[model samples]
Target: MNAYCFTYLFTINYLVVSVIEQMTDARQSYSIAIKNICQSFKESVEKVESIKKDSDTNNNNEILYNFWHVFIEKFQNEAELHENVIQETKAKVVTPLQCIVKHRRQQISRLKAFRTSTDYTLKECAEKVNELQSNYAEMYRIHREILQTKAIKDLLNAHNSYVLQLHMTNAMKAYYHKFVLPQLMQEFEGIVRENIIGFVQIFEYFCSIHTNMFDQLICNINGVQLKVREVSPDSVVSVIVHNLNKNQNPTHWQLIEYLSPDCDCPEILCSNQIIVDNLVKVELRDKFSELKRQFAELSSFMQQNVNIVDTLKTLEKRFDFDTQTEHINLNMHDDIYRKENEIRKAKIALAGIEVQESSNRYATHQEMHSHSSR
Candidate 1:
């Protein structure tokens, strides 16, 4: 039983340490991601600043305007938005994680100390119980020998009876009170306490990870919002027009003519609409889909963590000692009940021997009286 309890404690400790390591790894990964994102942001800022400096003297202000509106500013905004969201998410997750990790490490240290103390006490109790059992065996042996020796009937005088009574009074009572009951209670309570604490720690680990994942989902949602705001129809039109102007090398009127050669062309900006449908829609749709998929995955993992927490709660309830109204009895009770029955049997046997010895003494007295009368 002691070994089993120790094994359980070790296992719980190992698992908690493993989770902490995973959290550390996750934080490292986030650090790397944030570093990369910040680097990208720095590069985009430099690129946009360089573009502004170079294009300041450009003759075609229209080209400069379109490029800045379509590409440079868009990249800047996207890079800044991503950097902000990633930093925010890290703040939410990493800060709490550090605290939790610190707290758990302290908890584990305390638990180890408690387990060591309990183990020492248990050993002492075990040694005391073993000593008591040995004493009991010796007492029973001497008792049985005294009972069987009929030749010593006269020898079993006042002093022997006093000694027998003294031994029985001291040894039997002490064995039950100091050795048996206290040991049983200690074992039961220790097991319950150890397991309950273990389960609570596990539950805490799950909650921390669950919360972190939800924070990540929030970050992704922020990304989705930024994408939506930045990837507009006007942005698409700017990109298309810039690209067309670069490729065709035509004046605005010539490009318009090329785009709308027919007299009965669609009244709307049919060319921009076509570019939006064919190019912008497909790319944005995939982006949105990817974000939604990420969100769903985080949600699912969070739910799994919730389920684990529920299971831990149930286990904790089973071991709870607050109310006897809902006690989850241990399996050791049957063994304890068996020991109680054996003790009762011993008491009955001892009583029978005492009565037989009294009867023999009375018969001997009567026989002596009869002989005197004769």
Candidate 2:
């Protein structure tokens, strides 16, 4: 019976030590994996920051778009792998450790009760020996039963699923908020800058065309006329204001005279201004059409990019990663607290048994009885 008792303690103590060691190793591995994930995430953020810097400096839309596409593909793949690791750790490592801690605590309580028993007789001891053997078998069965319980299985599934979702939420927050959103905004600004530059160039091109057509019209009329007189700035301004106030669209020649107050030009009648405006309009029609087409294309592209930014904002709000992470952390803290308390209680019980064993020696029932009688 004493031998059986020692055997039970040895087996249980070995199991407890093994479980503790396994838990320690598993936790260490998980910590390293989490560290690696954080480091990789930092690296990815830095890469994106560098890309933004490049886009700002170089203003290369093609390069920025291409890099963004490639980076997203790679980042998503890595995030999926990290998510798998989180789920796997929760299911395979966390679940088993929780079960083992529970079962070990129950075993410890039973062992302590049996060892501290004060009643001993030859018949009773024999029955106790049989009971001890039954207990050992029951311990194994209980372990298996606890593992097969619906509650344990449910806990395992729920924890794993939650962990996976938490990881995914975190990934989305990192990718979209930190990475994608900033880049999209930067790119949109760059696009706007390019559009402004394009519009300025188009305005300059049209101004040059109108000036050349004005010069040609003036020269043609002057070649046939016998006299040419310098037009006064006051006269030009009065004509422009009068024509504009009358809701008459100024001819290209009138527009040029209005634009260039310092220019020396011959005075022109409204009918010639109308003819010059018609010629200039015909020359500019194709350029204006091309500018409108380009403007529409650019506007559509800008709108599409704007939509992406808005969509990302919606996802950023929806994910609420910080709250999800906080919830997971709280649950983890609770689990750790429970497990640590269970281990502390088991250790105290084991220490008590050790003290009893060392102080009394492995005395047999007869020896214990003699000592008690004395």
Candidate 3:
């Protein structure tokens, strides 16, 4: 009986110890799993923190780089603006001044020849006078046309410059207000106004010249009939003059004068009492008709050359302000295109960095979990 009881007690105690050992082993495994999980979580957090720090550093660096790049870009833009202004000014003022100087020199030589002639035959003297007059007329025509065209071009340039300056100044003001005025600001309105006023004065002067030239052209045409009648007879000349007045008004006659040879009729023709006046009238009328036809052909040829409806086509092919303005506008458009492209590239680079940072963060979290499990 005693043996049986001791055996049962021992068996029960052994079973209880086995169960307790199993429970302790299970608890130890659970503790180890929890410890590993906590370690993995800590490592993951450290990795995430490191990644965040790296991302922050990278973001800061990128910001600094972008800031420096923007600063450099602005500096370069400012320098380019100054360079463009100088080039534009030179093209507008210096180039035209040089052209004017060269034209004046040629005019002076022709005037000198007219002043220095000693002895000449009647024909030679007339030819020389005609040559002088033709040169003067040509110079006057060229100068007048060139000045008119230049004034228009300069006015456009001045307006464009003013607009560009206004835009640049406004951009600068905006930049200053956004980025500079919070720390350091200065007033630039006076300087900007000075430049604008100077340019306005230049524009006003060009306008004045344009107005004067317009008035001069009107005056030049006004006395054409009187001048023609002074050199030719009333009866004979009246027919040609009337025809000229009929076919082409006074304005058209001025163009005809530019094309036709200057007729130096004898002063006797002006008087009422002239021998064979009818015959002379008929002959002069015939000549005048021929002259009108020739003038029409010459005017047509000039119009073809100039791309304008006039007898002054020679000035079109010549280098002028319009050509220069066209060139500058083309350059400005190209510059704007290039700047836009650069800005696009910068935004693309920033996006790429963001994508790379996201991919790296995911990979870093996975690596941290694997290491903690080990």
What TM-score, over all chains together, does every model reach?
0.24, 0.20, 0.16
Q: Please report, in order, the local distance difference test score of every candidate based on alpha carbons.
A: 0.37, 0.34, 0.31
TM-score, prediction 2: 0.20
Q: Which has the greatest lDDT?
A: 1
lDDT of 3: 0.31
In candidate 3, which residue pairs clash? none
Mark the regions of model 3 whose C-alpha exceeds 4 Å error after superposition. Answer: 1-84, 118-374
Tell me how far the alpha carbon of residue 75 in candidate 3 is from the true structure, in angstroms, after superposition. Answer: 26
Each candidate's root-mean-square deviation in Å?
39.9, 47.0, 47.5
lDDT by residue (tens digit), candidate 2, 1-374: 12222222223323323332343343345445433544544454455456546532322232223322332232222211222333444444334434433443444344334323311211243343344334433443444445545543433333222222222233333333343334433432333343223322332332233235444323332321211122222332233233323542212111111111112322331111111132233423443354346545545554554565555444445443233344444344344333333333333233323322322232224345666899
Question: Tens digits of per-residue lDDT for model 1 on 10-80?
Answer: 33334333333333343445545434444444454455446446642222223222322332232222212
Ranking by TM-score: 1, 2, 3
Kindly list the per-residue Cα lDDT of model 3 for residues 1-374, writing each as its tens digit: 11222222222223222322232233334434433433433443344335436541212112212222222222221111112223433444334433333332333333223222211212242344345445433443444435465443433333222222222233333332343322210112222223223323432332233234444323332332223223212232233223323433221001111121123323332221211222233433453355356545544543443343122223323434344554543344334333332332233222323333333344346556767999
